[model samples]
Target: MSEGPGATAHRAVTVRGPLSDARASEQARGDHHAAPLAAASWLLTTAMDLHRMAGALAEGLTAESGDDAEAVARLTSRWTSLHRDGGPPAEHTRLEALVEIRRPRTRRPALLWQWSGADPVAALAASSGRLARELVAVSQAAPLAEAFVGPVVLAPETAVHFVHETLGHSLEADNYRDYAAGCGLVVGSTVAGPQLTVVDGPLPGLETSRPRDDEGHTSRSTPLVEAGVVAGVLTDAREARRQRLPRTGNGRRAFGAAEALPRMSALHVARGTTPHAELVRPVRHGLYCRGAWGGGSVEEFFVVRPACAEWIEDGELTGRFVYGFDVKGRKISGLGALGSVGDDMGVFNPVTGCGKYGQELPVSMRSPSLAFDRLCAVPIAPASPSPPP
Candidate 1:
């Protein structure tokens, strides 16, 4: 791949963290026992000028490495400080301590992409007409303006929410395998109305672009639902064949060696007709949901946190609710309960990755602000993870 400005290069190695490779391999082979993790990291140049050199090194390694096992061992040794069976314990302790030593930094509006051109950012900047109007409405309607200030792009946020709630969590093949709730359970079931449709594609215009999945397959969009009916399950090649469905290019991985699984990319909710104003005004006692921070849902039971919600009273935009909602019941049930869908769709580029089966990768979601008749909500509380060791 050609390297551009602001680009850098690195060499990587994978190793077990707080665990041994033998233990990780055993666990992977289904002899599950408690183990920390098999982790990987890289040591590379930070200068943008080293991009070409980095690429060349990576290509050289792949071409010249004698074998997979030898390559992996060399990479692991170079990137990680191996502590065979027994170490001074000082090494492990120091590494554990180092994890929390770095001070948290303020987040900024930064761009992260590979081999990107100037056109995409330009498109996002130019497409802000509707977003600008929506943000004005949100800002004015917000109970407190000072609390909400940044590059407020509504369309992208809307797209993200839609994909997260409706697509990403919904299409997981594991959920389908377990006969779990939400989109998976109703795979072949028909929809009740025109309120549902989902498609995942790495379409050129969408932000979550992937030319080829880690599984070495050309990417393409996979339709999961259509016109509120249970159309199909998202599938990788394996699941596609097993379930007798077409491979939707959902195969993805954390890296080249990691096993692939069905994952969503550039999920898009089917187009709808409800105008932005119309979706908001009709909510007599509901919320205009926007931007989601993070969430976890199992079998359609989930709690969306740090989400921005505006209280709707009468037929007008109202004040902000500040807190988020805990959506209970079956996920598909809730989706089946969708009250209205909006016309504008957006994609979110969160500074986070999607983790499944211990692999993490960059992902994005797209959706529009939605309103429901009876969404569950609650107050925020203290977190459990240690602030910093």
Candidate 2:
């Protein structure tokens, strides 16, 4: 038995006593326990098989490692709310549930594998104090500067931030079909370099990583672009068959509500020979885009609200870009201005989800702190969709 993110343990525990059917019923019926929100807690005690194996593997993998990390403390909780709408169909009340997991450490215990039936708070409380302390230590000591070194935790929001802004929604087949609104940087027609490529997959161990898609399709690695050449788009079952291209396991939806599209998972641009220092060394004055608050782009126009940024002087990063400059430019020019690429990749989490055509899907995108020769900084503004045909 094993526990945590990479754990592979299987076991079950049963509690025999007075069932709380009454409490659950009361909560559902708007009684004393029935409120806008409801919560439950429990103490999960394993027979110690999973945790023991996890400890052994951790020792083997981290032998002589200098970096400090937390033990795996995965807290997956869900929040539900009732919705009533008046529309074409009829007036109805619907329940929506949101599930999330927070595995702060490199190693998680067996609790990560156990599901408590839609209740996330109880799963978190099951962990001991030792795990909590480890998480705290990792948070306090681990600086974002070390992001260039190894695998870092990327929540869903951040993952979507990278994908939507960097890769996922940008390279859709439809987007490139007839020079659609924001799809000018064609795969084979774009830039040229050995370091430049685009890849998407449902690789195991990633939050967006899944063995099969919603259409019962098996996952496979598909090259969106190879060394600046057009490879293909992230196609779903329909698109794959329509275009006569193999499915890339991209068909997915937001909890089975909306239709699937050519979504992305584990999307990234591979690293080049440039060291982290050299990647920024050539820049005498430039910007570093860490994350995005909000922005939009068209094939002719792309704008981004920088989460954080700093200035470069003689290859050294000065203080944060206090002038508050942001990134704005055309897709072709933007991609053309790229001076260097990093070897970093961002993975999926629960926070960020891709939204398109009234649907949202899971995704992740990776890239180094790319350097650009000259990036136009424009002010943010209210979004106005392009004029309809």
Candidate 3:
């Protein structure tokens, strides 16, 4: 609850490649009866591109390390692309890659990554290369002994995760009630800044887009937070009736056999007019956080670990910093601390799956870079140093 000495501020950043809505439509209109050989050719081309990109990235890292065998221990990937017609149409393609950078004497951690979009091969290459660089930096840096507790910026990619965990989850009718079953969230509570608006619905061509819920309910855009106020919460028919709230068409099931529950589709934070530089320029000392490996929550309290982060001095990135701290805080409090939002919005191809009960649902998030004024980051002990050879 109290800021400690050595406490520094932090922010988050994520870069996603471009996806063409037009191309998605074109694909939808193209002949559905293409030859099997043509489909096979496309898959082969994508596979080769991924293979080349991974090899090149590993080679670059190895060259920098001055060891031929230290660049990569193993590289494995899985690819899935399918097109289906019937019951409102369904089409999807995905590539998941794991890259392990070899180190002397110690077993290095593997980077588990994924991509889905119009050009997944290109996305995979770019993401993989960026991750390799981060791993190298992580290996050479010293862990922070003290935690940072203050203002921070959440990069577009990081903001997506932050919003999803803190805002989106908190706005779920069931989840919110589970945590506040007796008191419940106030409908008009001030949850964030005036510039922060959150929405959940279908954005066709994007990864989370769906024409209907698993129960065959037509999808519609629902505003969860409007201009900093709690406009609404995602709910299914049962929860809506139980709570006397309106159904927002968010009821969804993981599969045909699973029961329906309230779930988010393409949840995103509306962008603002502020230039990204404006968000960081005023902060004399803070962090530029990037990437979300994964995180967990209990009630309204949550902890998220960034994949990589850098020190920000005088509003500019200064040096790469060890990322072993948990950005921990209460959900509402975190959103309330929003300082500014940027115009650079990113809609990531859904990679991480959201799970509740015994089912996993595919979800996507979009957000601009966001800044928060007083948050907490608790230092986590770094992974033990590798044993000497």
Candidate 4:
């Protein structure tokens, strides 16, 4: 919260594009109608002068706010424009048209589509159209399934989210101490197997992505997991110094928050050669989590609310749907139980925000489908809201 030379700020708002999503996501959340979304005031965060703090940074902050905030405010009429029934148009869905500033612009402009096969920018328009249709179709396809336990194939979107909630959050430098003390997450220890790797960095040309951290540290990729080992943890200037670790450019803050802390920007779980279609090949009886309600992790325990899932029998989808299922497991056990990783790394702009310590931030994840062996899922109440993570 220091108003120093390295200070940085972010402007944000939540919106859903196209009229259909505004209506559908309402139902997706078990609401009868799409309620209006309102954005809060801009957040300005200050921390140690990253240049002075970290000698070899890639860039520095400037006094002039010559970036997307101005344009975004103008378009939203300082947010009065957000009153419109529909949100940002389809052509502007990828968000490249509205703003080019990556370091400080974070907006949940829309949650139209989720795709896993190609470049995010090029596929945004088509992906949203396709996914919006899928959301409706999947939800209406069938009734909920009975409680079950076995192998499970988490869709690309849900899989990345599982990693984000479990492993990614544990990698935050400040959160590392808490987990290490109680959850057995040792830095140099091999927790997840060699088949997986996770990273958090300034992934340019993606929505809700950041180039430099809030503390003015340049966008640098920090390895959270590499070839199955807990390679490194994320850190802002304060935590890095406090913990005697290197800064990872992961500092972030939200409006109405006390200060910037280490957080993720573009979280990526490396892909594998397994085809998306063949992910369920080994599952004799299990669930295929097509979409997720939301998930959370505390210490080592975690729970994922899969909004829509299909039963898999004899290595194929049974075509019957299951609704409102919770997949619960321990972090280390789940990672070690990873059965397969798909090549189709999904890119998504979900409406559900990532919340930490009561602050919510718009973020995105690119991950592939993941299959796990011996995952136990129980049925939950049918109609409920996704709890904040």
Candidate 5:
């Protein structure tokens, strides 16, 4: 292991076993006919003597986790991609495995679990065993209910995506300096409900938790949003110096890669007094997502695909599986839609990392189940639910 974040810990050792990069791309796709997450087109690579290297690079990966099953499931979707780019020693002995679990009635709503690591046996066993259980959860699901395109009740596992995308990305110094400001995300302003509070810092006992940033600054909590207001922005040493702002220890970068930039470490969304189940008790014509396959954002538009969901009507879940549903909308619009926050908080230390400027870095997030309104829910084909009541 590297001693310091800035130190280039290049391993030049020879491998005698099967080792693969488990950093997965576990994003769920909306298409039924499209290639599954397992269809990673990996090319063979060879690294023997000096100046010799070979690998199987995977593209179009969905990002998964560990109590943190939500993170594992998400990163493992596109799990079989092994990188042999002759850059890092770990890349030379990488492996990827994807497990597909179908509901028997239809293939449209299949459960995918992917794993990657140096050891193929361990990776496969982990991915397959976990996904098998989730498949059972949706086994008795009603015939792929028709899509519901309205408000949503997101569980803690799914709620992290909401804050990570619309709110988390918005607080990045670069984002705030560029696009977010134009979208009305000004600092020191109330952007969410009074109950909503978001903080970015290193968490103890969490995987990939950085005690210090890549640039050698002690990691400290940076409040991005407090009581629904934009309280702080993440900054690296460079940005802090340039903007005359506090360097919040968020500077990050990939090893042997480019320079570090301001980034998020462990994001903590404070829990509310409301119970988790209560959020769904009032939804009459919406879907309740229990977990997410994966999610991301592009400027103002954000999309989070629900891996497992239930139909809610008459103030209770129907216990029916809702598949292929997408929660998407303008980031700014979703800010004020905080209906409720749950007391159950989830910590996600996924195998997959966040990407920006072509650099991917490992990160973790924590949040409670959050309820929001006004965001559109778009269910894909073959699993459409009935119209709202």
Candidate 6:
């Protein structure tokens, strides 16, 4: 079978007795050794099927784009042997695809889409549709009004990104070592209300789950925060050794990445007991941020642009607002302002790249609707009106 660039095949053989005798005895054992081989075969078949589906999707996009738009797509299929070091390797396969579209001679920003999952088709289609709708809405949207600062209820999806950007990245061991940043030094410090907890690990059945990291370390769930107190920080071998901290198995390397680093896999805020309705019911006047576009951080402070938001009045949604707003605050302060956490949660595998040290890795986050008190929401400069056509 054809493999992508950097793909490597691994094999191992064990003989309990002399080769001839072992083979004869194994044959008499009733094909017990065949089980692993069968499983590996099935995994390979699945990966090949996903590859074909990706190719078909690319072809369709190319035809639809015609010559006006340039389209580029790539599919990467990863198969890992879970028990490679043991009796027989357990095969694991992961598929990720990315599609980029740009209209030549136009000043519009290029649209990027990405997906990662066992089923490539469904993930790809969902990402493409979401990107298309977002682009259209952004292009047609009018200038927004001044943003209201204070209490706000973040949608589940928006909360996922917020927790990822504000907490996950800030807790990386490298960030702690390099800049003296992160919550590492603040272990046992209460950073939020008792209802807030954050976790990071290779959660099973998730698109980002894995048995081991790139450095051959076994994966385990690590609690970054629990009951509002700092619990732990993610660590790779180097950082763990330097800081004399236990490794959390967070070492990860991007495709074609030269070196492994401490990167989050499946990071999320644990769900709270608060019902979904009650989380927003107490909000008298606030914004309900449903989505986000671009965001980044400078040290402990962070900023994210809301893609779409609605006004909340009398503990209910008023209407979809058209203006852009910036959510800004220090990480710890933002968490400390948590009014409540909802029971309904949303998981997201983002298409936009999360860049660090010039390398981008696949990551996922999940969180319930979160309400914050005393946070700043400032209006962005109005978009320049389209030149009179």
- Across 244-328, the per-residue lDDT of candidate 1 in tens digits comes to 7676666765432235677776676765787877876665655555544556655556545433556566766565544323333
Model 5, 40-152: lDDT tens per residue?
Answer: 22211211110011110111011111011111211122211121122222211122333333222232434544333433334344334334434544543444345455668
- lDDT string, candidate 4, 1-389, tens digits: 22222222222322222222211111111110222211222111101111111111111111122222111101010111111112221111121111111223434121123322223224544444434433433434454556676788888767877888888788888788767435766677787667788887766434556556655566688888888888888887788899899977777765435467788777888888889778888788888887666788888887887657777889887767766568878888888888778888776654345888886765668888988887778766656878999
How far is each candidate from the true structure, as Cα RMSD in Å?
A: 16.0, 13.9, 11.5, 15.6, 12.3, 12.2
- Judged by TM-score relative to the true structure, which candidate is superior, 3 or 5? 3
Badly placed stretches (over 4 Å) of model 1 are 1-159, 181-184, 324-329, 384-389
Over 4 Å off, model 3 = 1-41, 65-105, 125-140, 180-185, 382-389
**Deviation (Å) of 358 in candidate 6:** 1.0
Which is better, 1 or 4, measured by TM-score?
A: 4
CA lDDT, every prediction? 0.44, 0.43, 0.63, 0.57, 0.60, 0.63
**TM-score, cand. 1:** 0.59
At residue 369, candidate 2 shows an lDDT of 50
Best by TM-score: 3
User: How badly does each model clash, as a count of residue pairs?
Assistant: 11, 16, 11, 0, 38, 1
lDDT of 3 by residue, 1-389 (tens): 11211111111112211111101111211232332122434544454455455556555655555543232211112221222212432223233323334444445442445555556566666577556766565655555568888778877777888888876777788986787333334568777779989889887546767776654567788888889887888887778898898777787765332357888878978888889889888888887777667776567777777766677788787766667677878886787889898998866665546877766766777889998887777788767999999
List runs of model 4 lying over 4 Å from the truth.
1-124, 128-133, 136-146, 382-389
Q: Provide the TM-score for each candidate, comma-separated.
A: 0.59, 0.56, 0.77, 0.67, 0.67, 0.69
Error of 4 at 276 (Å): 1.9
Q: Which whole-number lDDT from 0 to 100 does residue 266 have in model 2?
A: 62
C-alpha RMSD of candidate 5: 12.3
User: What digit string (tens of lDDT, one per residue) describes model 2 on residues 1-389?
Assistant: 12111111111222211122101111122221332222323212221222333333233333423322212222222222211111121111111212211233543221122223233333334432323323233222312231121112122222234335544556664455525323555545655455566677755434456565555567677786677655667777767777676677776644434355666756755655556677666766554444344455454555565444444567786544322224555666655555555555433233335566666544544454555565565443436999999
